[model samples]
Structures are given as structure tokens and as C-alpha cells.
Target: MLPEFPMSRQCPYHPPAGYEELRKEGPLAQVRLYDGRTAWAVTGYDETRRLLVDPRLSSDRSRPDFPVLVPRMAAAKLVALVGMDPPEHDVQRRMLIPSFTVKRVNSLRPAIRRIVVERIEALTADGRRAADLVPEFALPVPSTVICELLGVPYGDHEFFEEQTRRMLMATSTAQEAAAASAALIRYFEELIETKLGEPGEGLLDELITERLGRGELTREEVASIAMFLLVAGHETTANMIGLSILTLLEHPGRLARLRSDEGLAAGAVEELLRFLSVADELQRVAAADIEIGGRLIREGDAVYLPNAAANRSPEAFPDPDVLDLERGTRHHLAFGYGVHQCIGQNLARAELEIALYELAVRLPELSLAEPVSQLGTKPGGSVQGILRLPVRW
Candidate 1:
């Protein structure tokens, strides 16, 4: 029998234990999914990157053969951008690219810095020596930045955050995930309607006036896009911030280096992204038969590209297991590869760089309040992150 897919990580900082065995098998290995179906698990770095850009692979989550590692992910098919393929995906991605371009993200650096500083002040206020970084700092910094950019009211963050958490939880039942998704869709639908009536400077308002008013896109499509941005924009970055902090704390020497040198922050953030690989895996389906990695992928076959495994592949990086802040290479698939690569990567990079740097400089004495083993993680979730990072300075 083939090894089951999505083997659990024995350590949160490492890839799933089964991934090593799968890698040893070959770059492309078959694994069984939850529904007793077998799919190709692309564990090699070069093979994963090549497969990501291949036109023969489709990202259509609605397809019957699309490999969902967990059942709850089936409810995410409604996400207009990530679940789309070819002409449709290209069109939707184009509509939102202007907002997330490098120039645009660079312009937001001052604002991001301001948000990070404010969060740090709040975290250290009242002479507090200990706090949960997830809620106080890690979550709020990205949450506020994305909220301001997307025109979503930061006040309602708790509501949408809860809904998103439910929808993304791997253990959620199909019905439960569907319900949570519905609630988010409804919320975005109402928000989009309001934006249509009264526009603002945020990206959502711009989309409404430019695309929706021109009849180029439907209101539902707009809502789905907003929902996708709202969820993706914050959740992944927030998790990265928390985990990056923990990783740095474990390596006091590197943490001290980052604290003393502002220039090292950018490279450190890139290394952290490569090391963490917060998002579990990229999913796709074979659009046609393709031969690569010494194996033939039949048409309609499901493929799982585990980012953690690919980032840690020995062929890709020297001493792949060691976290070197000076890795200096941004060639990893933390934001994925190809046309479907993360649209918001620029923004995420800015947030991570700003948050980690500011935290290191502002609170140089920061350390984990609780033991690493005692920290909790999101249970069986597709995204790997600490549920709560108790820390002190």
C-alpha cells in the first residue's frame, strides 16, 4: 500500500516526517489521499518548480480529480483566484495585480512600519513583561495592514478572522467548512454592496468602480476575490511572523545579529520564509498526460507540491536543515512559483521584514515565556503556525 499523503510533522519547525521517506523514493512519488485515491507528491525542488509552471497542470479546485489533502479544503473551491485556471485565472489575477505591485507595496512601507511600531508599543505598554505574541502583535500587525489596503473595517476583524479559521481548519467537517465559507461570502457580499454605493480609496472600492461598474466582473466574483484577499492577506503573514520570532529566539546568536544590523533584516526574512514554509502544499490537477521526473503523470491525475519538502531539498540549498540568516537566496517556493504564484507576495515580504526587524530592535531582550514543547499549534490545519506564542522581554 502507498504511504498516505500529508504525513503529520513530528516537529512544527520541520516538514512532515513522511516527506523524507517520500523524497527518498524519488522526486515524484505516489501517495494515497484521504478518499483512498492516489496522487503524485512532488517532493523534489526542481521537479516541483517545473511542474508549477507547466501548462498541462490545472489549478481548478472544482475539478473532480483535484487533490484535496483534507476534506474541508473542498469548501474553498469558491475562491475565485486560487481555484481558477488559464484564461479565467489570468483575467482575475490581472484585475488585482496593480494593487500588489512592487511599486505599490514599496509605497506602503512607511505605513507598515507605523503599524508595527504601534503594535510593539501596545505589546510593551503598562510595563507588561509577558504576552501572547499571536494575539497582541503577530496577528494585529498584518491584520491592520491588510484591512487598510482592502477597505475592510479593522473593527470587524474578529468576526471574519473566526470565520476564516473555521473554514481553513483541516479537521472541520465538510458541512462545517461550507457553513463558515458561506458566512464569509455573505459578509463580503454585503461589504462589496456598500462599497459599490460609497467608494473609498482602498482596493475593494477601486475594483467596484473600475471592474464592477464596467460590467467586467460580477458582484459575487468581487466578493469572492475580497474574501480570498482578506483571508490570505493576513493569515499566512501573521503565522510567519509568529513562527519567525520563535525560530530566531531559538538561535540567540542570529537573533542578536538581526537586532544589531537593520540591513540583515531583509535577508533574514527571506531565510525565515524558506525555513518555515508556512503554507503546507500547492495543489493542482494534470490537464494532460505529461512525462517528467522520470514518471508519467496521466491526464486528470492529482498532484501535491509540498513546499516544506521542496524548500528543504538538499539539492536546492546547502545545509538545508540549518537556518542560516545569511542564506541570501530568495529562490525558494515559499510564495510558490509560476503564473499562480502568490499575488500578495510583495506585501507579505514587506510585512514580515518590517515586523521582524522592528521587534528585534525594539525588544532586544525578547524570549519565549514558555518552553517550545509547550506551545500549541493550529490543529491539523493546512497552514502550519503556532496557535499561541507566549513570550517575554
Candidate 2:
């Protein structure tokens, strides 16, 4: 029998060969999390999609009756858009939606592609042959893209990077992640202040000034939203670049497809996000009452919708385990559904598309330097990320 995996450390991304066994067992499986709390993991595509949009499934965990699975290390009062239900959640999400519109995000694509190409060019230059792509390229690519859009100073990339690193490292204790998050919040607060005083041209500054000009949002609200945008903006795309590269390296045929079909790069990124399924799990509380997967969820019951598992469910994608770049790319829920879908997804798509295109065109000879198993994965925390990826052309 497989050992019980906890709700906290249960990494669906850390699956072994033939991991489909877990998804096939059922749509809803009980997981014993690292904290020993039982979490219901949803695996069906429709089920997961429905769960995300259901008004009955609440994102707020602060309800005294509904206990959260893990310490809410990332937020206070959980004002996060992802951690909310309608009305309140809608308002918070709508506040950031304008900044992440396709038009706004598309304007950043040229700049994003420039950064990806420059980084890749730098990586292969001046007699330096091989370097860990994560730090040198993968991590910074998205970070630079987000910083540019947010108008946050790139001078603080090192600072943002350190905090992001500690934020996701496997061994970082809850206190460590909490400390890093606090530091991030504090840093954003200072940045917001500077943006307020200087009023430079970037998303953060624009957002602050716009909201302050209107009576819609306060100074603190602007800071909090800016902080959320920065963290979510960079963190998810960073995982996509690394994990997508690894997935391509593991499947040369797909990588070759990306090389030949430049137009397919966007869909390729979506497929990779689905196949790699790096976002892993989401936490929510039942808002009222709902029956899902034949189980009744009571009001205020904590629930976890495992995005990784649902991506692999056969009922959703025909031959679900297969990573076909040509498959139904639009159906993937790597971005959640309804009001809570990632606001920065359009920007993320541009970033991922550019990164994959650059990697495919530039590093046609690239392959893993060692067995994939040698790489480490963090089973818990926010983003499902690899510790190191050794690669060479």
C-alpha cells in the first residue's frame, strides 16, 4: 500500500512513473497532509473546474468553523483574491484585472521576449558553456518581465529573488516562509510609498495613483494588491519556465515540435503547464452546501482542489497523461476558472510563450545533463518547483 501523503506535502507533481494510478482511483481522494489533516483532493477536470467557480466553495479560511489545512503564512485576514468568494473576491480581482488585460500584457511581450533572448544569449557567451538555467535564466526571465510591468525597480531583483527563493524552498520552515512573506510585504509597502511620492510609470504606481484618485481603494489596499501582483506574477511563471523546459527535455519529440512550429508555442506553454501541472494544489472552504463527486460538502468545511491531479484525469483529457502539443490547449485549467482565474495569466502566457520559443530556437541541442530523478522537488508550499536542473547542449 502507498504510504499516506499529507495535505501539506502531498506533491502530485512529485509522482513516479505510472502515476496515473492515483488519478484513476477516484475523482475525490482523501489525503493525509503533512499536518495530518485530511484533505479531499479533486481529480476530475470538470469537477475541479466546477469546484473553482462554485459559489459554495469559499476561498476564505478565516471562518472560525472552517479550519484551514495549513497556517495562512502568506496573508493576514486572507485578503488574497484567490482566497475569497464572490462579491468580496470579485471586487478584489476586478481591481487588478485592468492591469493584466490582454492589451496591457501584450505591450510587455516585446520586452519580455527581449529579456528571454538576452538572458539565453548571455548564458551561452564568453566561453561559459553550461549553467543552471533556473537562476541564470528561468527564474530571472519572469522576474524581469513582472518587474518591468509593475515598474518595480530591477535593482531589487536580487532582493525579490532571495525572498522568492526562501518563499518556495522545501526545507524552509513555516516560520521561514512566513518571515520571507513578511519581508516581501514590507518591501512592497516601501516601494508603494516611493511610487506614491515619485509617481513613476509602472503598474504599481499607476494602480496606486488611479485608486487614490478615485475613492475605490485606499493606500493600504493599493500596497496589498501590488504585493500580491508582484509575487503571483513572477512566482507562477518562474515555475512554468523551469518545469516546461524539463518536460520538453524529457520528451525530445515534443521539444522538436516546438522547434518546428513557432505558432504552436502558446498552446505548447498551456500543454506544458497542464502536463507539468506545477501549480499543484489550492485551498478553499465550502461557502454553504454542495454535493460534488457524490460527496456532500457542508458549509465552512475546508477543501483542497488538486489542480495537478485534475489535469491528469482521463475523463477531462482524452489520453490525459500524454503531453500532446496539438491537443485541446484551451481546455486546460492551469489557470483557475471564473472570478478567481489568475489575473496575470495573459502576461504569464506571453512570458511562457517567449521563453519556450527562445529555448527551442536557440538551444536546439539542449538535453538533460543527468537523470531527471536526481533533481529535487518541493512537495509542499505554494509553487511546485525543482531545486536544480542540470542541462547542456
Candidate 3:
């Protein structure tokens, strides 16, 4: 019998214990999902990249054969940019590319640094020595940055954050997930309508004026896109920030080295991304017959590409288990591979670089306040992260 898919992770920083065994089985191995349905788990680095770029692999969530890790995800599927296939995916991706380009992200560096500093100051205010970095620092830095960039009022973060948590939580029921998604879509729709009447200088406004006004996209489509960006823009980065802090504090020598050498921050961020692989897996389905890694995938067959396993593959990274801040390789699948790769990756890179560098320098005494084992982690979900990261300075 095939092992159940998404084997639990004993340690938050590492992949599931079964991942190495699965990889040993071969690049692609059959694994049973939560529903007792089988899917191909792609564990090899080269194979995962090849499959990601293969045109025969479909990201469409609406496909009946599409694998849903948890029951809630079935109801939460909204075919936005990530879920879209080419032609449509290419078109929509191109529209948003300009905003996330290296130059554009570079231009926002000052703002990102400001946000990071603001969060750090807030966390350390009143001579505070300890804090749950998740809410005080990690969460707000990206949330505020994304909110500002998307024209969504940051004041309403509590409402949307709750909704996003519900939508992404693996424990959520189908109806609960659907309701949270619907609430977000409705919120974006209202925001779009308001921006239509009174414009602002943000991505949402630009999409409305350029795409919606030009008839290239409908209002609902724009809203859906906004909701997708709003959720993804913050959640992943926030988790990465929190986990990066924990990982760095665990290795004080590396943390000291990073704090002393500002130039190493960029490479450190990349290393952290590859090491953590925070977003666990990328789900897809075979659009047609495809053969790779000595395995045949028939049309409509579901596929799971676990980024954790791929990033840690010894074949791809020498000393893959060791955390080397100087490992400057950017080939890791942390931001994913191929065309559907994260649109805001440049922005994410900038945020992580700034946030980590600032925290290390500003609070040289920062350390974990509690045992790593005592920390709560998010339950089974598409993404994996610490629920609350307690820290002291």
C-alpha cells in the first residue's frame, strides 16, 4: 500500500520524515491523499522543475481530477492567476509583471526598509525585551507593505486576516472555507467599485483604470485577482519571516555573521528561502499524457510537487541539510519554477532581505523565548509555518 500523502513533519524546519523514503522510491511515487485517492508525489529536484514547466501539467483547480490535499481546499478553489493555464495565465501574468520587476522592487526598497524599521521599533517600544515576533514584527511588516501596494486599507487587516486564516486552515470545513473566500471576493468587489469612483495610486487602481476600463478584464475578475494577491502577498512572506527568525536564532554564528556583513543579506535570504521551503507543495494535474523520471502520467492524473523535498535534495544542493548563509544559489524552487512562478517574488525577496538584516542589526540580543518543541505550528495545510514565534531581546 502506498503511504499517505503529506506525511507530518516532526520538526517545523524540515520536510516530513517520509519524504526521504519517498524520494528513495524514485523521483515520482504514488501516494494516497486524504480522500484515499492516489496522486504522484514528485520529490526529485530536476523532475519537479521539469514537471512544473511542462505544458501538459495543468494548474486549473476546477478540474474534477485535480488533487485537493484537504476537503476545504476543494471549496476554496478560485481560478485566479495561480490556478490559470497559459494564454490566460500568460496574459494576466504579463499585466502584473511590470509591478514586480527587479527595477520596480528596487524602487520600493526605501519603503520596505522603512516598514521594517517601523515594525522593529514598534516591537521594541517602551523598552520591551520580549515579544511574539509573529504579530508584532513578522506579520505587520509584509501586511502593511502589501496593503499599501494594493490600496487596501491596513486598518481592516483584522477582518481580512481572520478570513484568510479560515480560508487557508486545513481544519476548515468546506462551507467555512467557501464562506471566507466569498467574503474576501465581496470585500475586493466593494473596494474596486470605490476605487473606480475615486482612484488611488496603487496596483488595484491601476488595474481598474488600465485593465477594467479598457475592457480587458471584468470588475469581478479584477476583484478576484485582488483577493488572490492580498492573501498571497502577505501570508507567505509573514510565515517566512517568522520561520527565518527562528532558524537564524537557532544558529547564532550565522546570525552574527549576517549582522556583521550587510552585503551577505541577499544571499542569506536566498539560503533561508531554500532551507525553509515554507510553502510546502505546489499542486497540479496532468493536462495530457506525460512521461518523465521513468514514470508515465496519464491525462487528468493529479500531481504533488513538494518544494521541501526538492529544495533539500542532495543532488541539487551540496550539504543540502546544512544552513549556509553564504550559499548564493538562487536556483531553489522556493519561489517555484517556470511561468507560474510567484509574481511577487522580487518583492518578497526585498522584504525578506530587509526584514532579516534589520532585525539582526537592531536587536543583536534577539533569541527564542521558549523551547522550539513548545511552539505551536499550523496544522495540515498547503503552507507550513509557526503559529506564534516567541522571542526575547
For all predictions, the C-alpha RMSD in Å is: 1.1, 2.7, 0.9
Mark the 10 consecutive residues where model 2 has the least summed lDDT: 3-12
lDDT of 3 by residue, 1-393 (tens): 999876767777888889999988999999998899889999999999999999999998767788898888988746789888988889999999998999999999999999999888888889899999998888889999999998899999999888888898878999999999999999998998888889999999999999999999999889988888989999999999998999999999999999999999999999999999988779999989998999999998889999999999999999999999999899999989999899999999999999999999999999999998888777645577888899888
Candidate 2, 93-171: lDDT as tens digits: 7767787899988877788889999999998898665778888888899888888888998889888778766765555
lDDT of each: 0.89, 0.73, 0.90
Query: Can you write out model 1's per-residue Cα lDDT over 7-107, one digit (the tens) per residue?
Result: 76666677877888998889999999889989999999999999999999998887877877788888754557889887999999999999999999999
Native RMSD of candidate 3 (Å): 0.9
* Candidates ranked, most accurate by TM-score first: 3, 1, 2
Question: Residue 9's C-alpha lDDT in candidate 2?
Answer: 30
* Number of the top lDDT candidate: 3
Error of 1 at 151 (Å): 0.7
Overall local distance difference test of candidate 1:
0.89
Q: What is the lDDT of residue 91 in candidate 1?
A: 97
Please report how far candidate 1 places residue 199 from its true position, in Å. 1.5
Compared to the true structure, candidate 1 yields what TM-score? 0.98
User: lDDT at 374 for candidate 2?
Assistant: 73
Compute the lDDT of residue 268 as modeled in candidate 3. 95
